[model samples]
Target: MRLPCILVLFLGCGSPDQVQPEIKQLNEIPLNIRDKTEVDERTATVNDTLPEGWVDVKSLIPELVLDIRYATSDNFVGIQLYPCERCLLRKEVAEAIAVAFEALRADNLGLKLFDCYRPRSVQEALWRKVPDARYVTNPAKGSMHNRGAAVDLTLIDQNGHEIDMGTEYDFFGEKAYHTFTKLPAEVLTARRKLRDLMQEVGFKHIRTEWWHYSYQIKNYEVSDFRWPCPGQAL
Candidate 1:
């Protein structure tokens, strides 16, 4: 969904109270991800570092709050699919996210990333579990994420709490739609805040997921490799 989101009305969600919590962590994966070394020999990326033209978002924004869901059992698959929690985006995309995050900082806000730069092998694993193209992108055709051009993220406040956007991240269905307006004004405002900032930085939103964005300005080839986990052998 890297294409620019259709223009949304922003409502100065600078105040956390504006995006009040409707359902606390509903369908949300609690943030408990920690560093680990548990690569699946069958699917782990065989590389020792990020591939060329790729950069870990943390390198650009050390304070990046990465809740890489697939790295833990909290995701839809209910399994730890990644050996470690990392946010690898193409260099340009990573830069764009950094710029967006810095822009939000003036408002005392931040972006919490959920997913980024998924490996093709990981995409296949997701496809294996949820073959529905409507939910999981077909590994055959490839997702923009598979090409390191997409990200799943949400907005956060100064205290590092998620700004309620009505539903939680990765919650599929009608309520997740970008146009699903049957929501509190603040929630709509919060969603618009995220869309506007991301779009300003050249990211696009999908109609169904407020947290998903793509880096359509530039494209990269799909990769089967993963970033090597710390303490994992070469």
Candidate 2:
């Protein structure tokens, strides 16, 4: 049976040419949180200690590899946006991620998250650089990342290498879409596997990004909460 994918109001209103997983009408907001003045550590200091309702994915499934792109300059932003590499999600969302990870391990394939629980301040930073809603979700409406309900991830093989998924993580083209099937059979199968696994665990996907998934089983508000970095004030 096919799992349900509720198109929440957060879906951005874009033309058919626009290819974003979550696009919303622009509702800009001023940021009131700390910026990247503390991200230089680039350390993964996340531990069992967490916020009241958040759960660190590392704590739940330590074995799941983290390829946090924003912590490094490898992402499309081309700069370090995160204070550190901590994949904190809402309690239930993180649990669903853990379930997906274990299920993938049964086949020697695993999960590696690229982005999770982005800070509102960072969202503003991204908007400043690429204020287009087709790629960056407006910080005002707040993407699933701000709500700790979304994840950007890819599948890894038994050798721990990311399998081919037609395009890179942040490719802004039709090739990265799940509906774009003019590619190798293996790439399509890989995308389908990741999507199926995420949906099975109560996560929903967007059309334009194969690696994007949001857990919508529960409702939550957008937040400006940045994860506590080592030697930094929370």
Candidate 2 accuracy as TM-score? 0.79
Kindly report which residue stretches of model 1 are placed more than 4 angstroms away from their true locations once superposed: 1-48, 232-234
TM-score of each: 0.79, 0.79
Tens digit of lDDT per residue, candidate 2, span 5-74?
2222123211222222332111221211113333212212343355667877776566778989999999
- List lDDT for all candidates, in order: 0.74, 0.74
Could you tell me how far off, in angstroms, the CA of residue 231 lies in candidate 1 after the best superposition? 3.8
Number of clashes in model 1?
Answer: 2
lDDT of 1: 0.74
